[model samples]
Target: MLNEHAKLLALFKQTGEIIGRKKLQKMVYIAKKMNLPFNEKYQLHMFGPYSEELSLRVEEVCQLQFVSEVKEKKGGYQQYRYELSEKGEDFLSMMSFHFPDATGMLEDMNHKSSKFLELVSTVLYFEELPKKEVAEKVFKLKAKQNYSEADLDEAYAYINRLHQVAPKKGAYS
Candidate 1:
């Protein structure tokens, strides 16, 4: 029943801790974009791609004591930090599941800033659109972000690097 949840747990197991709700969302979205085993549905929100299902799943894991959520006040807003709990480690140890080898991918993303990941995920979201069109859409939709052409170029490069390293179409036991 916790097959998907276990995958999320394994993500935490690999990356020490994720420090923002948006970061967590973007990381998973980017993984899904790379054709990883994530099954969440996402829509473009104010922060780029957002997923309510993933949010609820994270909440469920927190409620089950398999993960921990810590709320911190960040000036006018709040930020959340997530990590796998001891119980979570125990649960994962007992579950038998296999996912692609995404360790390097996850580590690379885990070290990135949410703003960068936001741009990367946004670019991936509009990937089907022409390059210029994607640029226009990003500038229009995320005007407040102040992303420049150079940033877009960097995001594309990052996406390409990720693609080069993405796991082949197969499951890992």
Candidate 2:
């Protein structure tokens, strides 16, 4: 089985671009919420669900030359983007043999916008919200997404199922 670091490299490989750190974090968090076998533990943070372990793994991958980090000034603020290095691609290729489903999962997630991931992840983080209240809270938190009640309902149904099946403790740690 691929370890969490290897799984992250596979995600970078699947994305095939320099993904923003926040996007990466949210993607992993969503994957975990979806019961995709990621082992990271997440808690609500300023930007929504955040994981220190994921951040540490990113740094580790950078140090290992499996991934490269680039800093860019976007909207006059510095942001980091991560991409798979040649070594990382090679590692991902090897890992694919052991975990074929990972590519498909990453591909599905890569198609979602960061904002959408954030919306779903935030809702999942607060799964206890009453069914009727979910849309209100989600709209308040992510008004820019323009999500409808129907959207929140669908997401809630899906995430709720995954949350029920997902391991209670860290799966990867």
Candidate 3:
């Protein structure tokens, strides 16, 4: 099994772009829900589903110069964006063979907006709900986000498609 840092590095490599902390958290949570062996514990937090383990791993990688963190001013507040450093990229390339499914999952998530990822991850977090009930349940759970039934449907569809293609291999399968 790959370590959390390796999984995060693979994410950066697959995306090939800078990612915000919240987006990175959601992406990893989604991958976990899909049974990609991320092994991070997720809980509902300020943004939706959050993984503190992943956050710490990101910090470690930054400290190791495996990833670069840039502080950017957005709307008068500072936002940290992360991208894999050259060393991180080299490490990810070396470790890629051990995590083919994880790499594929990250590739699937590439180009998705944070909002979309948040909605989908939130929906998947409540996976016990019946298919027909998912939209209603997500609508209620994310009331502050004002997600409509249509939005729920779209997010559910995306999650469902991902599962169909990826087909998680463990207990969730």
Candidate 4:
């Protein structure tokens, strides 16, 4: 069994790096993306660390917009999903400042950019919203215009700065 911290890290990544409880429950336990496999995929429900507990922690810590429920199929049940609002991204970046690992920390910063965009893509895919509609929704939720486009550039710049500061391998030869 995966530990709670490992489960959190994996689930956060699996939910397109931003997702809701129902999907998280379904995917986390058996996500092939995370290299976990199980028989009877749909039947594998309730990936432990429980729904209510995870939801509270996610809401308190994750700096993402809490979107409405998602219906998997037409006339099917609705499950909640989250899209990272701009403020949410800001919130995540702020939290990253405290990451304790020094070695390869630059890689983590670089990963954050891709993760943010991936989260946006997840929102578009699950919500069935067109590109423009999703963009508009993100703008409204984050209370900022041009966030998706502009923030990518900002994230890249930070990543580059970190790379410059990281010690170069084999440079002393």
Which of candidates 3 and 4 reaches a greater TM-score? 3
Task: List where candidate 1 sits over 4 angstroms from the true fold.
Answer: 170-173
Better candidate number, 1 or 4, judged by TM-score: 1
Question: What TM-score do all the candidates reach, one by one?
Answer: 0.95, 0.73, 0.85, 0.30
Per-residue error (Å), model 1, residue 116: 0.8
Better of 2 and 4 by lDDT: 2
- TM-score preference between candidates 1 and 3, better one: 1
> Rank order by lDDT, top first?
1, 3, 2, 4
Local accuracy of candidate 4 as per-residue lDDT tens digits, 1-173? 22332334433433343334544443332232222321112321122222355555455444334222333433465445444445544444444322223334323432343334333323323245655665565555544324665663453454345446643543311
Across 17-85, the per-residue lDDT of candidate 3 in tens digits comes to: 655777788887887777765787888886789987778888899998999999888997888888889
Q: lDDT (CA) for every model shown?
A: 0.92, 0.73, 0.77, 0.38
- Candidate 4, residue 21: the lDDT equals 55
Per-residue lDDT over 1-173 for candidate 2, one digit per residue giving the tens place of the 0 to 100 score? 44778877766766666457778888888777665667888887767799998899889999988998988898978888788899987877777443324555556656666766777788877778776676677777767668887777767665665556555544333
- Residue by residue across 94-141, what tens digits does model 1's lDDT show? 997776668888999999999999999999999999999999999999
lDDT, candidate 1, residue 34? Answer: 86
In each prediction, how many residue pairs overlap at the backbone (N, C-alpha, C within less than 3 A)?
0, 1, 0, 2
Candidate 4 residue runs with Cα over 4 Å from true position? 1-20, 26-49, 59-74, 97-173
Model 3 CA lDDT for position 55:
82
> How does candidate 2 fare on TM-score?
0.73
